[model samples]
Structures are given as structure tokens and as C-alpha cells.
Target: MDAMEQVGARKVTFIDVLRALPKLAPDGLRMARGAVGLVTLKPTNKESIGHIFQRAAAKHPERPFLRFEDTEMSYGQANALVNQYASVYAAHGVGPGKTIAVMAGNRPETLLAALAGVKLGAAVGMINTNQRGDVLDHSVRLLDATVLVAGRDYREALNEVDTPTVLDLDTLADGATSDADPEVCATLPASTTAFYIFTSGTTGLPKASAMSHFRWLKSMSGIGGLGVRLRADDTLYCCLPLYHNNALTVSLSSVLSAGATLAIGRSFSASRFWDDVVRTRSTAFCYIGELCRYLLNQPPRPIEREHQVRVVVGNGLRPEIWAEFTERFGIDRIAEFYGASECNLAFINALNIDRTAGTCPLPFAVVEYDADTGKPLRHGDRLRKVKAGAVGLLLTKVTNRAPFDGYTDADASERKLVRGAFKADDCWFDTGDLVRMQGFKHVAFVDRLGDTFRWKGENVATTEVEGAIAEHPDVEQAVVYGVSVPGTDGKAGMAAVKLRDGTRFDGTVMGAHLANRLPSYAVPLFVRVINEVEQTSTFKSRKVDLRDEGYAAGVTDPMFVFTGGKYVTWYPDYPAEVAGGKIRA
Candidate 1:
């Protein structure tokens, strides 16, 4: 925790640098090899995901490639099924430039279906399973997929949506028996679009972000081979929805890179998490911050600390809980990385740093920003870069080497561009995230630019406030957001919290606890004790719904308002402090 604050200012030790230098050389060579392979890839037969899997199967035919609770598939077996499925898919006009949208949950078949399409040079759309009706229709139509592979459970979900040729996943290969490699693999190039991973629709409709096989390979080189550093025997446990990049690219790609095993869970279950990890004999696991929080909140079981996981990887592990999560779980390294489903660049904690999002070679900037308005602070014609250690808006440069390939729609939250950022005619892609520019090419995530609010002339970060609230022993989880008051100048901070079992919400004690941790201006003005927090499939709290229903009559949850130094019952139209906004102050 102390090192987090000193990240950008700390002096590097010679011993540490010497140790890191040797490890970096292998990563550099690995990434360079991937770059060279893409350019030199044979047009007909090499470097695609399918080709990589085939090579692994040929080398390690008997090694387990995928492990589910009831199913264990060896590299040879999985590749054979993938080929069989590919044979079936190719018959339906699935080939180069065609798209195969898959609507399913995390299962062995779900991953097999995606690989089957990619083997035939078809872009696989990883559609969100939670989506239905209009959103589902838009997602399906967005790709105009030549075919759709849907699992049995999700067939009813797609019944109402307009989709392309739908194929029942289990019944797809009814008569197909060939397990040999598909002929289409010979014609596929490395640059072909491999997948269309949709963004988590926590805010709104998800966007289909296109990713080429080359980029996916780059992630394998950077995060898999270098960061997680998986071996042939390592099993990476990934419970996140397969549609997300963390699962599909980071965890799975890393496994493929090492010719290792992949352990899949149908969905996240806090109670069953450790059990799954132990059962799969996982050496590593992917995570989001919310997943960590859920685990921390649960009463410890005997197996919680006893596990084979030496290193854990993924993004959104907040600094506040980093030490606690590691200390409790006895993890050796945490590859807390920063990258989006659509972003071209990624920062991996290859050095196994404690509090930073790690380092990258690509060019990026943390420019000064107005958190409240979500605007970059510009000086004359260019946005001003933040001094090292200062929090600011994060922007990554677009280049031929690392291109910004994600699609941006008109209805997006905002135009994700910063024109003339530092020099004339140069444009940077706004990452929509606030980050601290740690020295030596390192960056630490602060909060989302949109997850901030101006109150009493001070910008309050919701993540920071949520961290403070969640730190309390009695609180299981907390989500902070800004809400409107009748006479307030700006939005006021409000929190939706879930308390631990058998714990009572004592507003006075909670208020005092927060006051000690956060400044008066940053402390949440209103607090609601909820039975449960509504979360997306990825464990991201749905803040929009909570913010929109702030202190409203429809909210049956117990609500409290900060008044003076204590909190009081908050009723509908509570306007006692609405005039002065003393609660926010």
C-alpha cells in the first residue's frame, strides 16, 4: 500500500534492475518473434490460432488442454473435435471474411465452437449471453454473421432475436465424423480477423470489438509467455464469461502459448471459487476487482489459503486490496494488468510489481484532466501532460505497429479521441480511464473518468470512496455514485452498500469510519444498505441503475443521509440539507 503512493517517485535499486533486465530479454525476444512471424506468416498455413493449437496438439498429444468439472480434454482430443466442428461449419459457407457469431456461456463446447470457426478463417463473434430482445438483435445484426453456434441453454434466448443461420451446438456435427485438420487452415493468414469480442455493457449496449489473430498472438507473447509465464504443466483457471477479453484472450491465449491446460468454470461463484481452483489444480487464475472483493468478504474456509496458484493475472485489482488479497491467499505474484477489450496497447506486471499496472513499450500519455466534466485539460492547442505521479486522463497513440482497431459508434458515451494532443495533426485515442503515470513506463489505474463527480468544488473519485467504504469490516461491498439534489450545484456522492451477514448498519459508526478515511468533501452524502448489488456477468456493479434511483421512494432498501457529523434516516424528498449541500461538504 505504501509503495503504491511512491510508485512514480521511488528510486530504482541496482539489484532490482539487474534482476529485471535478464527476465525482460526473453519477453522482448518472444514479442519480437511474434511480430516477425505475423509479417512472415505463410498465406496459406501458419501462425493463426487454429494453427497454433494444431502445433500444440502434434507436440503434446496426450497433455490435457482443457479441464472442466466433469470433462478433461487432451490437446489431441480437443483439436480433433475442433476439426470436426470446423468441417461442419465450413459446409455452411463459413470461410475467409465470413463471421460466425456464437451465443453461449462459458463451457468447453463454447470455446470449441469459437475455435472451429477461427480454424476456417471466420471471425467469431463472442456475443454476451445476458443480452436479449433489442440488444441481442443489434449484436447479432452488427456482425451479419454467416452462421451462429448457440448452446442448448441459450437457444431459448435467441428465439426472439433475429439471427443468421442458427446451429444447435450439440447437434451441429450429427453426421460429421472426420477429425483431421480442415483444408481451410492452409488458406488462412495471420492477419485475418479472429474474433469480435463485445465490450461489457455495464453502461449501455455492448460494442463488437474486432481483433485479428495477429493481435491475439501478440497478447499471447506479451501477457502469456512473458507475464503469466505459464509452463506445459500449468493450468490457468478462468471463471469470467468467455465473451470477455480477459478469458478469451488473456487466459486462453496464454494457455495456448505455453501448450498448457485451461480450466473453465461456467460462471463465477464466490462460495465455489476455491473449490473449483483446487479441483482443477490451477496454477493461476484470472480476476476482476469485484471477484477479489467477493472472495475477501466470504468467511474463510479451510481450503481458501491452501492452493496451487502461484501467480494470478488480470485487471481491476485495486491497490487498496492488493496486499490483503495476496496476504490472505498466499499468492506469489499478481499480474495486475491494464488493457481494454478494444485497446491496442496493454500493460502487464511482468516484473510482478505490487501496486502498479506494470509497464509497456508502446507510447501513451497521462494528460491533466477535469474529472467532473470528463475533459482533458488543454493548454492552447495541446492537452497538457500530467507530471509523473499525478492522476490524469490516459491516452494511447495510434500507430501502424499498434493500431486502434476497435469500432466506435455514434451513440458511444463520447468520441474517444484527443485531437492535436501534444503536437499538430497528431490524434490520441482517449481510453476513458483516469490513471497515474508512474515513472519508468509504468501506470497505475485510478478510476474511470466517468466515475467521478464534482461536489463542493472538489472532484470525488467513486472508486476511492468505494475503497474506503469497503475497507470497513462490517461492509461486504460498496458502490459509490453521484446523484442530483434539488438545489445542489453539482452531483452529490451516494453509496449503495451490502453489509456482512449478522452485521447491523449503524449510520453513526459508519459515518465516523468514513470520516476518518476520506475527506469531508469525498465522503458519500447518502448511503443505502442493500441486500445485494446488481452486477454484470463480469462482476462490475451497474452504477447507472443505482445512481438513477438514488434515495427514491421506489428504493425499498434502507437509506441514510449524512447530516452534520452523523447520518440520519433519508426519506423521499429529504431536502433539509439540499439547500446548503452540507452533506457533500
Candidate 2:
């Protein structure tokens, strides 16, 4: 029997176990090596990130540390630059407990400024550069930063915000000296707040998630050293913006911990991606699900498999495209993981399992949940665990070993905690995600709980529908949400789609596409032709407002309804037909 059959049976045959052996071998070796390092060269609680960089520079002064386009900075050179910036920040009284808001695109100086703040025992607020007007203003003010460091490209966006001290990145290093490492680096404790990474804020305004130095160090050792398993000679390529934790903590921390080189890209470009990999000679690269999908959609290039990339790591890789991506790109390994900026739970694909989010060492549970209310179901005041292979809400137990540092907003943080989840006085952090728990602590991510809606007595995952719609060649982007039908018992699926430039929508083609790709009940009943889909800085589609807009006939955007076995322009009579029982949802 094949893998799918085995999964259905909830049984791992000898063949299945054998298939995982090859992937497990390297991880075992890497974990063994990491164990030795953990015992022999563990970092002290008092040593800060600056001290870690200092030690790496001392050991590999001449090795390349960072590469951006044509520019390369050696460990020694980068350390010198960091020292200069640290000195400047120190002069401005940016130290312990102070917050420094940093807004910039992917640039070498951006990393330098953030490191300087960490060096001085200050919390660095990594602001998304794409934000503008009121959103940008609110972000800066929300952090209550003592200083604002704006990149040259984003000066205009900062004009509206009222900050105490605003400094330009272009001239931050002009007059500063390459002074010794800041004194605070040696004194800061592991519990000190290192930075604040904002949540993607798909449902509402973003909240600042506090990242402690202790967590950063753990990420470096856990994810970087053991998960990616990079060597000193390896160069990890990253194109995601630094404002997000995937790039800032996962990619950067791994490279620093392994003393490996980091190749930085100005931004992600599907056309230029392979060329960048070839240019940097990257041995591994970081990715998101969307980035992988974009690359897969592009026409095959001769240079696609020419690079030295052996392992690729990141989250959001869909199971449908997982095998195709690795096979097409000749990737030897993929380290797909599941984690959130604020949540304490993390699952790493250390064993190289296909389609599974791997296992977590920390405690977690998949409990029965209600689709309508988007909350875990309770049985006599006790949370119920879902059966194996059943989709349910994922919760992580909050304890000292796996603590939730939470967000800067106390109330927002409290809202995420579910007290007495399983027992009295016990607390669990709700991940707000649904997953199917596989055997051996592995999980297959299903969808966000809020995005799953009931339709036709069946639960429909918008992400699944959106993924199906995105597979169409003509569809550029798809935002799937549920709209309440007048006569229907539950919401009906509606998709807001942006087609490829200059391409026109053909309802017959789209209807056929959906029919072929998704289940009959899961297919969207309506489609809205939109110019563009609004997205968070992290590229997550905003769906709350889209759901509110629904299938309003007065809206200017052209709308279509699937009827008579094909898609047709939505007319004024469509709602009346449903109300009169002439049409069925």
C-alpha cells in the first residue's frame, strides 16, 4: 500500500519506517553534535547577543558573515560596524528598558541598527516598512519607542508620526567610532527583552510580541544548530523582510549560531530568485508557502537547479506542493516548521517527514472545537481531546520550560490564554489553528480556526479553497471567505480573485477548475473580480473586511455566481431567486 493508505489506517508499516530512516540519520548526527556543544560550550545567562557575535568574530574573523548583492562583510568587518553603531546609540541614552523603533526594508544597515539596540540592552521594535499613513503612525506610537531609526527610503512614511528622536539610517555610521563592545552586553540577563516582533494582524491591529534573549538563544541552538544543520562553509540565503520572525530570528539566528554566511536579497522576486541563489552560491534558502508557490508557477529555467542548495527551511508549505517542489528543485531536504511570533509552541521537521509539521518536545494538545464559535469544546468543564487523525484546535501548555512571553499589550496577551484547559489552575495558549494529529506527535496543519466555516452541513476551510483557486493559471490571487446566504443554514463560500494582468475571467473555466480541484461542498459558490487583494505586511490576506462586504449587489466590483453548472454574472434577481426557493445554495 502507498503512504496515503497507511495514513488512513493510522499504521506505519515496515516500508514507511524504512522510508524515514534516510532522513532520520542526518538529524541524529546533528543532534549528537549539538549535545556535545550544549555540554561543553553553553552560553551563560548573563551573556547577550552582542557577546555571541563577538565570540564568533573572534573565532572566524576573516570568514564572510553577510553578503548583499556585490557587497560582502567579513565577521570582523560586521563586528566593527556594529560597534560603531552601538557607540552612537549609547551616546543617545538608548540603553536598558528603552525601545528603539526600526523601520526599513531589507538592507545591511537595517540589521546593523537592530543589533546595536540589542547590544545596548534595549528592546528593538522591528516595524514593518510597507505600512503607511495612520497604520504606520499607530505602529510607532504603540511601541512607545524612545528613538526612531528610519531608513532613507521610508522617511516620508515617518513624517506623520510624532517621535521624540528620529534618526536617518543613511548617516547613522558617519561620525561614530569603532568603540569596544557596549558594557551592557556583559551585564544583561537572559531574561531581558531583546526585541518586539509584531503579529501579522490578519484579523485586527497588530500586537507587539515580546521576544526575550533567552528565547533567541534557544532558537539559535534548537532551530539553527539542530534543525537546519548547516556547516561553517554553508551560505543561507534569505529574501524575506527582517521585520518578521521567520527571517529575523529563525534564519539569522541559525546562521549566527553555526557561524555560517548569510546571503541577503533586497526583496523577493520570483524571476530573479534562482539567479540570486546562483549569484550567492547559497547552500540553503528560507521560504514561505507563497514564495514556493510563486516559484513553482514560473516557467522552468535552466539555472533553477544549478545552485548548491541542499536544504530549504521555513513554514506555510502546503502538502499538495511539498513533493513537487522538492522534486522539481532537486532539494535534498526540507525543514518545514510550524511556529507563531508570540506562541511558545514550535514543531520542527527534524526527521524530514513529508507533509507533517514534525514533532514538538513541548506539551501540546489537539482538542475538539466548535466551528461556529471558533473555540474548543468542553465536556463537564474539561477540554476534550480529538481522536487521532481528526482535525481539532491546537493548544500548547504554558509552563516554565515552554513559557509564553506574550505581547506587549497585557490585555491582548491575557485573551490568548485559556485557564484550566485540562485541569484546575492549568493554562494553555490557544494557537487559533486547527490541525490533524498524526501518530508519533506529528501534525498536518488544517487551517486557522477563524477561517473555517460551516457550509451545507460540512466544514469548509477557506485556505483549502483558496489553494485550489490559486492553482489555476489565470488566477493571480484568491481570497476565500464565507458569506451568509439568506435561505441557507450556514455561510456560503465566496472568493475574491485577482486575475493575471490583462486576463479576463471566464466563468466556465473557473467553475470547471473548482469542480476538479475541490470537493463539491467545499467549492465556492460566488466569485468577485477584484483589482487587488489586501494583504498584511507578512503577505497574509486580510479576510475580515472581505467577509463583511459579502456579495452586495451595489458594490462596484463585478460579481459572478455559479449557477446552471457554470459561472454567470451575478444579477439583481439572484438574491430573489434564493429567497423564493428557485435557487439552492
Best by TM-score: 2
Candidate 1: tens digits of C-alpha lDDT, residues 290-345 = 57766876788989987899889988776767888899999988987888877777
Over the full model, what C-alpha lDDT does candidate 1 score relative to the true structure?
0.78
Candidate 2, residues 1-585, lDDT tens digits: the string is 844335332332346546877766745766666545433332236866777887898899999999999999999888888888888877787889999999988978899889889988999999877565544666788899988888889887677667758888888877786567776787887778888987633233457899887777777766776678888899999998898788888898878878999998998887899999999989999987657866876789989989899998888776767788899999988887888788785787776767776777778999999765678888889999987767789999987666788988888799888998889999999888887777777777666667666553344667767877888899999998888765333467899999999899999998887775554656788899999899888877887788888987567899998876678998877765643434543
Cα error, candidate 2, residue 444 (Å): 1.7
Runs of candidate 2 with Cα error greater than 4 angstroms are 1-29, 33-44, 451-585
The pairs that clash in candidate 1 are 44-186
lDDT of 2 at 374: 78
Estimate candidate 2's alpha-carbon lDDT, on a 0 to 1 scale: 0.79
Query: Which candidate comes out best when scored by lDDT?
Result: 2
